[model samples]
Target chain A: MKRSDYQTEYKTDLPVMVTPLPKTGGSFRFTLKPWHGFVILMACLVSSGIAYAVTDKENASIFEVLVRWMPLLLKGFIFNLVISTCAMAIGTAVGAALGLGQISLHGWVRKASWLITQFFRNSPWLVLLFFAMFLLPFEITIGGLTIPLPDWVKAIIGLSLPVMANVSEIVRGAVLSLPSGQWEAAESLAYTRRQTLWLVILPQCVKRMLPPWMNLYAILTMATVLASIVGVSEVMTLTGQALSAEGGQTYWHRFTPLFYYCFSFTATRFHGGRYIWKRNILLSTKHCLRGP
Target chain B: MTTNEEMPMVSIKDVHKSFGDLEVLKGVSMDINRGEVICIIGPSGSGKSTLIRCINALNDIQQGSILVEGQEVNDPNLDKLELRKKVGMVFQQYNLFPHKTALENIMMAPIRVLKQDKKEVEETARALIKKVRLEGKEDNYPGELSGGQQQRVAIARSLAMKPDVILFDEVTAALDPETVNEVLLTIKELAEEGMTCILVTHEMAFAREVADHIYFTDRGVIVEHGPPTTFFDEAKDPRTKEFLSQIL
Candidate 1:
């Protein structure tokens, strides 16, 4: 029986979602677009609002609880931002080196790069963070003077390790994606291998690399909340402290998911806007962009 | 040794090339004198493109000696950049760097390899752009230009280095029928101005018009060669006759 026939028989007035019939060979039909992410975000927000309204307390509504704590939470969010920025800077430099090494002519250099990338990439993030916390020297004694390293510095190093691996993947992928014609053309111009890479190849790769780089940055930003576990006093840790208060205990379960959902949506939106803007600028600025 | 002093601009002797078991060039030899234009014509896989590429040392032959301006091409100690500065090549695909504008593409090799003053190179680049009839496309990227315009820009780029000889490999083969004449005209202008040129082309009419000498290759061997008048009209070899009949 046809789907429309069932609807007519049941006398139902539900809106029908008519998707295209699947082809014979493949039985998969899933196409999620960029706007779908926004739709999902909006749906989450609306549902959470309805849930808050349904579970209204006598003394404090959801609005009052959020108003009381958001300012305090923002202070810690700043620290989270700082940590993420520092880690990204460190990761980018290290990852670029590894990526270049991955394509190095020397076999040992390529192997070393592969080993380093795999070691960090395959390990669990939490374990790496713990190792950094325990294994790193807390203080250095040089010439009878003591220099102490902060806990967040350790956290940054841990976070950057994974980011370094991911960025190396992006760089390698971007470099490989360029057509071989660019290389041959540069070579015919009498460009050295290094010059060909720096001038001809890498410049073309910048456009291909930007979107993934920004997406990785957004993911790294979200992962910065893990800094709280190492006693870095970031937003998540501060939120935990706020919820441990006497009256805060009542809203703990609701507030945690609410904060996470909001933060995730913001990061995703930042990434989406940034990727589009970067691609547009790259397209427009072809004349101004020059290679080494 | 006196003959060595007046050596041809490019000399390829008994060049044999192979990729795995497939031999592409077998015992092919040619001498290209200064200010002479030679057009290599052949069917597919006849080593026409390979012969021109070998002159620039783009493809290394297994058994041969290729001398460009008396410099041994295969010599490890010889600076390749110096040799390439004297030999420029244009591809069939018009492989312009997408990131650079037409002017920048022309200016790149001169400023970078020659270490010439940027201002001087830019001036020469602009002049060459005008010579190629692409005066208004100075600021346009390769992606923005049509195939004919891009090929002209590529010709301008190869001309920028002031090379002794320029090799064109099926340059107009990728262009539309309407636009092929512009690129061909640009090359013809260069030829008339006494630039040493070796072109591997399928355009029989253009070859007849522009070529000072025509080398017809068949199966990695130059089976027939002469001035355009005699080569086209009074060809004697059976293979050349058969080849001409098939094409004409």
Candidate 2:
């Protein structure tokens, strides 16, 4: 037996040989190595722990502060949850309409929709929140009916203004990014313009529309702090009050994905803001990746 | 069988189309008969593709009416989608949906457009896959296939809709040398089986072999049109002869 080489039945001076094999799919093939994966995982965890420990030594940890005031933290966390859910629902519905309107064939409709998105997106969210709370009527009468738009309405309007822009851009780009032929292809299949938008175009666009959706949600949580100036007893307002009482050197708004959910009434009640924020961030990431 | 023997299947009268200040088609007129394979050969920008697209209501004509199967294609009140259902189109790029699997792409138009039963569409889809000689590759995406295979899938997807007339907008211009024969042969077989096709093609040999009617266009006008035999063998237009000589 030869150790170096195999003896062939036929030898030829040719460029190639024919081989029948199954076709491979995709740009490149990947293989799983469990041992390598485990090593990488352990290394990542060890490095992250060392990094966090160093960060804690330099500053007083908010995690520890929230742990000390667990009861009040829980209260604030609930307020944070309410603002995000309400704001996101309002933003998505309004944004989808604006995005579709901007692309509408009608000249006036397209122009009107484009103007609204541009104005809201460029203006500061905090400024808009101030206007909604301060300038809007106390008891507006419409058709002999008296109703209050409420201070909470200001919070949602502020949060939704920017978030709607984000959602509108996402939806518009998703709709436009679809191939020009999808419209023609749908037409050839006997799908009406409205039916194509609902069935073919929107369904196809949703899969590509999810990742950016999370960023808009994260921004909505941060924007809720604007409610504090409006006398809304939301989480941020309560947290500011706690810091003012504690005689802390200074408190900067922590944008670590979540905050406390405090209920806003005439009297404010605090909850464990830390725990709720953590859950919100975790749930949001999962929802965004796994889809609605 | 389209029962419009007295009236032409597709009728275009005094058609004019423009872009900005430039006119692409200038007062063109033609009638496409029922169950006919017509080859439209011309110089670039002759508005051949646009003409067919207007027939399907994909492009709007500026100053004329286009009728498909004896119905007005350009009526503002007419359901453009329903009008398009009877007119299939094949592009130079073979615009198959990249996100869908091959079988799913072929099945979508039939199920969505015709509202056919899922089982029936699937059966027809399988038959189409077989007809295009793409067995064991139903699950593959269009992006995974070669240019030839993608074009074939585009062909099959249009076939699934069962359009009255299929418009070929230079479908084989994007294929490679060896693969061109495979696609042209498939088209030849279609012509033999009585598919009413309007082929906008660069391959003169395929046009000579399969076209019942041939129209040689030059700068948005039909310079000459007749039976394939006279049109190719003894072309009266000097521009067509000059064009054919450069390619051949």
Candidate 3:
């Protein structure tokens, strides 16, 4: 059917344009997506406002504060990056396994996966981090060899537990969202259950899984700061120490709002944040491939 | 069970199927002979589609025997995947693997299930694509193709298995009025090539033209069946005549 036919059949007011939009004759089309320019304005104003508030006679310029402290705080960011990357890797692996288990034919396996996912998903992240930090044996005796568990390793494990649960939910939701026709088609073709899941179902689920998985990664990235509570010396921990070392309570007014402004902008711009709030990317792909 | 014509290609004897308490197929039985094109026609609630699905064991009968080439379908020892390889099916919604191109969809089962060489199967797939009149469109994904093109590709995908029989369940019902004839033509070509075929269809005219045997079903039973000329033109049963008149 032609594009126009769809509009008529559905009784829709929106015109369906098959070809590209008519190009603006102007040489430069300085177009910003809806709220993008506003966000950039906000970020600049909010950041400079915080910097200006912290300024004093001794620290005459806000530029001096930034110049002095930016490098030191950035060094701590490497640790944040490390913890998040490690946790995400672990979470994705465990989550995928749990997700597959949730759909398993065996009753016990499905139940066990459900129990595990629910346990971590319900618990607060701070409580899990505390459990990791305090409950786990700091040292292990393996054939008279002492293996000390670092605080950062425990933090990563704690962060991953929640991430794993969330990612598994994403995987399960993605798999379930696929139409029953996909399974029936593969089954009719003589593909075994395992073969159908691996070859047909999971491949289709990847499109569904990606945006949420990326979203989960962003959440997990921010959550890495929680590791500082247990003295992991990540970005948040170092930022605190660096601020206090530079000054006392006065530095809080400077760096805290700076942190908030930077984080808000990062959260808004990242894959998990605004895009998920708008059109769900994976579902839209599905709609594009399979017409309404 | 010798190489005699007495034995049916697929024999579904007194098969019964139900979804919970609602019995979909009650004592349904039919014998599909080799090189025959059977078209099953009925109203919406009839067991026509269910019966066709049972032939390929897509739905298991609650009670009865379904033997394909004299092999019991529900035999515990029988590998269902192996059985299905020989019984190709085309669905109403052309369920082409959307990720794969048309040629890839056709080549997948033979290469994966039959363990055929990629080069050899690609040659056959290309030929089938050409036969479906989808030449130069082999590289297009299902999403890129029109409904008729997708259905034709689905037919080619089934034929790539070189199955003993092919089942088409309302293959053209989901298609446009203009595109219906294109999908019907592909099926007509298959029937002309002497491929054993069974179709559940709403298109009475096409069934009348192409079907060697026509089964008129109502509720969950095949009430009357005969050659298309006898069934469509001179239906014996009152229900068959009623169905014919309504559809015609």
Candidate 4:
């Protein structure tokens, strides 16, 4: 008999478990297992309702104010996301290169990676961003001709600088965690050292490295709102404009807290991760929902 | 190297290798014709493993020389990939890719390094797995197989490369006593089929049973070498007799 048929024949005495478990005290096992999920959802709705009721004094429906303000808020959120994603992409690339460069046998390459990483990590991000936006535009020159980058470009570079430092460290940690034997094994197969690192070691490190990297992405997304200080019109900036509007502004300005909360939450997309990825580590932000 | 008359497939001449100040292999040399099974028995850190590893340029040595089937080992001239293609190695740890299945592990070297035909490599890989009596375990990952089975898969993986010399680096030392038999049997079966092999092992009985000749290595030097019967029966070196007695 074939392997499958052999298994089936030998498994004749094994029990089949097709039918779902019977209801337990008026709820099924699957539903019972989702208690934490249900509780979180109920908690979210309750807090959102309470915040909407107490924080905003508008006599109109919360929905009406939201609808009027939605376009500008959405544009701001999309703007923030674009900036963060682009900056983080550059950060990751630079970081991986720096990490690899730092591990080089050459003293100069190691020193170069060290200095670059240190310069970004020790200094303040906001100061760098502000300086780049203001000073860089006037001071720098190429070929005896002075030219300036645009505001948004400077802002992205400045914001991305700090992120690159952290990414390099993370990449370095992942690379170092691999056993030395793994490298030797590849070498034993007569692969060159560089080929061994690229083919065998790096892919394994990536799988183990992704969780921390995703968490960093969340933190980076939150930090990118600082870009609005330079008139980049990120979510918080749009909120300020809506609240203190001269023209093309809505009544949703009075309900800034609600709109900001919803905007941040939705843009960050903090939902449905349990079934899809199954490796969530963040605790619930209940106070975030309940706060002004 | 073999043809009942040709140059030895591998020849090492006063080969000396060191790591920094720690000299490991000091003036060690050996030669083997094609299709001969030569087993190198040694105490720990005796450089038997390092000698075999050096044959394919796995580790570079500072002095003397090694030649594989006419190509100088440290030859700035030889293509490394081509040199490695002719000499396959099996590690004590099996070193099978944990993420890939047994069949996939066997197929990877052939497909990736040799660039062999996909369908042909698949068929050859299947045949190799069967040769090692791991027919039902092809789709299983290395982690899922027992140590003996994994080592056999590793051996089959080397066989898939169609190498002239297969270096076995203490291939059965990591296995359990019961499992050691299966692995030794698999290797013994290979030697009987006229595969050229260099086994670095402590299983003196298996080494005696399978090896055409035996060499006892100590402190990075080949102390004695002879036909297996003479080496085991009348080991002249005091160190060799002591080494054999302890392991036996």
Candidate 5:
């Protein structure tokens, strides 16, 4: 039946309830569920057991070696998390400003902001990281007091450069996507440009920006491994250390670190996936409830 | 320069407007008195919507002057915020903020921009919602309301400013056929209460019923204008007659 026919037949004052139709198409698709992390962890454990069984009887068990190094590996992984969190925070704040600048009424401000965004976005992350590491001073003297710069801090600064550019593009896209009628309506209501943007425009942009912003965070988390190359001693670098310290050329030792990295990244991605899934459900239900 | 009470609410003098080389309004002039309801009817692209948009300086005119309550609309030094407060507008699309409820949409500008007392503004907003026949749906967002309901909320939002003149630019154009009458009736009631209103509409019957003066515009200029009784019955311009025959 037609939607209008349903409305006419009901003839009620209550808000109409619309149930969204399920999507069609039967191609095989793989989506990460909340329980996928546990499955991956089990696979890693079973493989390590098989490796331990095949190894020479004189050496320590693979599980024993993995357990011994677990705490140190987790410490490095936690540091990676800290860097990712701080970089995302700084990037989002600065990127939001740069994005707003792209839409500025002044031609110079818009052009300069666009240039900065493009410059950082197109540059390689590793090149930017190397630049931050080499170009910055090891320590600075201010009023006879010295403050030292850490390697992880430098890595964060490098990673956040591209994050800021992507976020700026996201913000500009979200703002421009709104109907121009919104501006006209707000202007007709006597709101200043700043008030209209902050009050009407940005509030709506937040919903559109959230999913992509979270996706960026996940990609940045995986990119945290890049910091290992710069001597930040994150998970990847520590895994290399743990492998050599074990003093063995066994297959289990070689295969163990890969699982550690995979498991940690998967765990983080699982959390992000759950959040985005819940948000999509909320948004779809909202769309269904909205009137035609 | 005359006193506000004696002067026309809005006065346009030989206004000419263009968009990149295409002239949309050519030498259009009219005076709208206090408490008068004027409707400008024309074919598409006749500049009827453009004319009302200019009254509040939403669009700049290349030449000529538009004065709202004796204040120059096109003056470079003129405060548009203050002018907009005096001359409110309702658009065809009813661009209500999706984030705000109907009541909040009405109360927002007064509280935020004018810095009014929230308690008093809330009372006035509630009354306006009732006036627009949206009492039970005050908390509903614009997305939850029908097109007509959203348009009524738009009118109430404009009225909340208490402007000297209100402009409606095809306010009912986007409404469903079943809901158009509700919006028209609300506008008609506002006209009956002697509010000064200028409208650009295709609703000839409603224009005849409510308007004190009717203007027929064609090709960027007013072809004919008079009271609805005579303008519709005795149109002198061939363009006006042909336009009326096609629509009516």
Candidate 6:
């Protein structure tokens, strides 16, 4: 087809450009609506009420046991957050470089990056966690300085491998999605290839990359639970320990751990959702800056 | 030694370009003089755009040479950034950086590539933006502007480099009919200001009015070329006549 005809067809098929509405003070506020908060409160109340009614009269009430164990379980949950944050930080830093390597001008770099990304991305997350746990040395000596590697540190490394691969894919996909006209325009203006990629191409890629990157973070946060199997004392492991300590016979007591898990997961997701929404507004405002 | 004015600004000699199996330009040759306005008119697949693109080394030719001033453009060791700095191009899509305001788009290359002082570049950018007759739209993003306004910004962007010659590759081909005149008027003003311009266009009337020389091509070769008055009015090749008849 003629280039003009192809361009016209592409332009018509483009999703109508949405001019963002004027930002009022309230619009930029937190995304968790009052209804969401109410629903969470109701679920907590109903679950606790059910647990309180069914427990043996002589034994401690499910609510009382929960109150006793809440501090320990909260500590474990905080550890989970730490694991997720560290894993995500390491993954993003390594993954961005790997992703750029996939598009590098050197054939060897591109092929090697592709192989590494595919190898880690396709392997099961649980397997990678085990591999990190078993294969990595327990301690390393660097110039007379010894650093001990803890199980939780190994779990962070294990979880980061897959996150890195997935993030690599996200970066590569976002870069490729941009129109070729951007590169050509930059080239005609005498910009070097490196200058074009940094200034013109990558800045545009950030908006396209943001949503998927956030999605990967959410998945990585959930995957941190898998570290429990590899011997990290994360929330799942602590919950299992707490259940055994409370005398594992009662049916009513079993629901307490489920309740704790649900609450923690929901809390993380709510915060994640809010964060993604706010970043979207900030990026769009930077790029679009709605004119009068 | 030849004087600077005597040397052609851009010279092409027996250039042959191909895309894998298909040959687009078959030994095409042309010489564009300093301060001259040359318009290339042809059917869709006639290699008009490809030829102009070759002048800036945007497309590589399989055979023969292209020179900007006295320097060979196709040399492997040639600094393309240097070549591109001297020869600017405006595309059909008006590929303005959507992330930047109109003023920033005009100012970017001079500041980033040329490493000019930001204040001086900003001054020149504002002047170029005003030259394109887009005064109040300086702060508007490319997405917020009409197609004509965006194209004008694109023109101003290329002009910011202060290139010795500029190539317009069917720049108005993608615009609405109402907006086409605004873009064409911008080009006409640039031509009147004696900017050496080589345009590939379908606008016959505008070509007749502004072009110092007109080249008609068909089947990957220039069928005829001459002063616009003779090229358009006098008897010429049957293909040129046929192409002109269909368009005009």
Candidate of highest TM-score: 5
User: Per-prediction TM-score, chain A only?
Assistant: 0.71, 0.63, 0.74, 0.66, 0.79, 0.76
TM-score of model 6 (CA atoms) = 0.88
- In model 5, what is the error at residue B196, expressed in angstroms? 1.2
Q: How close is candidate 1 to the true structure, as a TM-score?
A: 0.83
What is the Å distance of residue A141 in model 5 from its true position? 3.7
**Whole-model lDDT for model 3 versus the true structure?**
0.82
Candidate 5: how large is its RMSD?
A: 4.3
- Candidate 3 clashing pairs, residues 3+ apart or interchain: none
Docking class of 3: medium
Per residue, candidate 5 scores C-alpha lDDT tens digits across A1-292 of: 5655666666643564543234348856586774775676677677767766777557677777878888887888889888888999999999999999999999999999999999998998888888888998888789999988899989898889889999999999999999998999889889999999999899878777876887788788878888989999998888788767776434434444454456556655555434553332234445544645
Give a tens-digit lDDT track for model 2, residues A1-292.
Answer: 2311222322332434322232347647454444554554455444544544655345445445545554675566567668777888898999989989889989999999899999888888888778677777776898999987778876776678777877888899999998887777667666777877886688667655765676566557666767877788776676677666544423323321223211121012122332343232233334333411
Greater TM-score among 1 and 3 belongs to 3
lDDT of each: 0.82, 0.74, 0.82, 0.76, 0.86, 0.85
How many residue pairs of model 2 clash at the backbone?
22
Q: DockQ of all candidates, in order?
A: 0.41, 0.30, 0.55, 0.27, 0.62, 0.55
Q: Give the alpha carbon lDDT tens digit for every residue of B1-248 in model 4.
A: 23334788888899999988888899988889888999998889998888888888878878888888888887776677778878888899888766567998788777766778999999999999989999899898776789999999989988888888899998888998999998888888888888899999988888888888898889988999999999988989999999888877
Give every collision pair in model 1.
none
User: Which 10 successive residues of model 5 chain A have the least lDDT summed?
Assistant: A277-286
lDDT of 2 by residue, B127-231 (tens): 998898889889887767888888888889988888888998899999987788877877888888888899999888889889999988888888899888898
Span of ten consecutive residues with least summed lDDT in model 5 chain B: B1-10
Encode model 6's per-residue lDDT on A5-119: one tens digit a residue. 6446456534454332346566555566546655765676677666656755566766688788888877887788899889999999999999999999999999999999999
Q: How accurate is candidate 5 locally (lDDT)?
A: 0.86
Q: Which stretches of candidate 5 lie over 4 Å from their true place?
A: A1-31, A48-57, A143-145, A247-285, A288-292
* Rank ordering of all candidates by lDDT, starting from the highest: 5, 6, 3, 1, 4, 2
Error of 5 at A7 (Å): 12
